[model samples]
Target: MTIREHNGVGKVTWKAEPDAHDYPAAASYLSLIAPGAQAGDLVGQLQTASLEHYKAKDMLRASGLPLLPPDNPHVAADLAKVKNNKALSPVLLIRGDLTLGIALQIADGYHRVCASYHLDENTDIPCRIADHPGSRVSALAAAVGGDLVNDSR
Candidate 1:
């Protein structure tokens, strides 16, 4: 468990890595935006990805997702876990495409992010982040000897 103190609420503890189930959960969510194989690839990368930390406020800003209310059942449950000193499972994410104006994908743990925000926006949440397959098109094109346009106009 890792601890970080905040002014409004007490310390929030986080697991060293994402829970084993988190990968499947992330794959399920990713499938909504990508094909099944791509989603699976993303999850595979997440499984081997290094752990990282980012502030709750920054994540919300990057994700462009509204904060779930503290009264929300899921968020409340996470809050209860914090109160009970139980560590939260790290989040899983897919890096956003700035060129495409795509927002960061919080594949799993949206509730936990909101819960952490309610406790303290500055809370540093642990996560495993993976790049979207679209971002790797350049490398794929290079290997296949194909040229693609950057149509981001």
Candidate 2:
């Protein structure tokens, strides 16, 4: 199925042809975020993010991350591991473009990102970015045949 957000209307479709079914609440949410976009276009691609060094503080600032570290115990443990240079893996991220401009959303490794930033403003964290619309509620709703309004809190 395909959906297009042109102007303000969400054109829900299947194989480029408009389907008769009404869009669920999740589709409505997607429509608002990805205006002037096709449903297929909204979920696009995944790639290994460029190995560029970014200032930790700047990255957190751009992402609107809190100054305090994560409260989760696992995150704290991971942070400690990372600080000790025991974390051999990099963080997973989804490249995001919101009202705050471009930022990297932590799909995984929030602790690592926070730890690296808090430890040193100059620290650079590695990331694997998924450059796509990053919204799958609509598709999930369609699959489950559930209304997002009722299913989602």
Overall lDDT per candidate, in order of appearance: 0.87, 0.44
Q: Which stretches of candidate 2 lie above 4 Å from their native place?
A: 1-50, 70-72, 98-103, 134-153
Question: What is the lDDT for 142 in model 2?
Answer: 62
Across residues 14-132, which tens digit of lDDT does each residue of candidate 2 receive? 13211122123223433564563542233232121333334557667756777555556755675555444453244444445564365655544455556555455555554434443
Weakest 10 consecutive residues, lDDT, candidate 2? 11-20
lDDT of 2: 0.44
lDDT, residue 93, candidate 1: 88
The most accurate candidate by lDDT is 1
Please give, for residues 1-153, the per-residue lDDT of candidate 1 as tens digits.
789888847779999988888888898899999999989988987898777889999899999999999999999999999999899999998888777777899999999999999999988999888776675553555577744433442
- What local lDDT score does residue 100 receive in model 2, on the 0 to 100 scale? 34
Cα lDDT for residue 115, model 2? 58
**Each candidate's clash count:** 0, 0
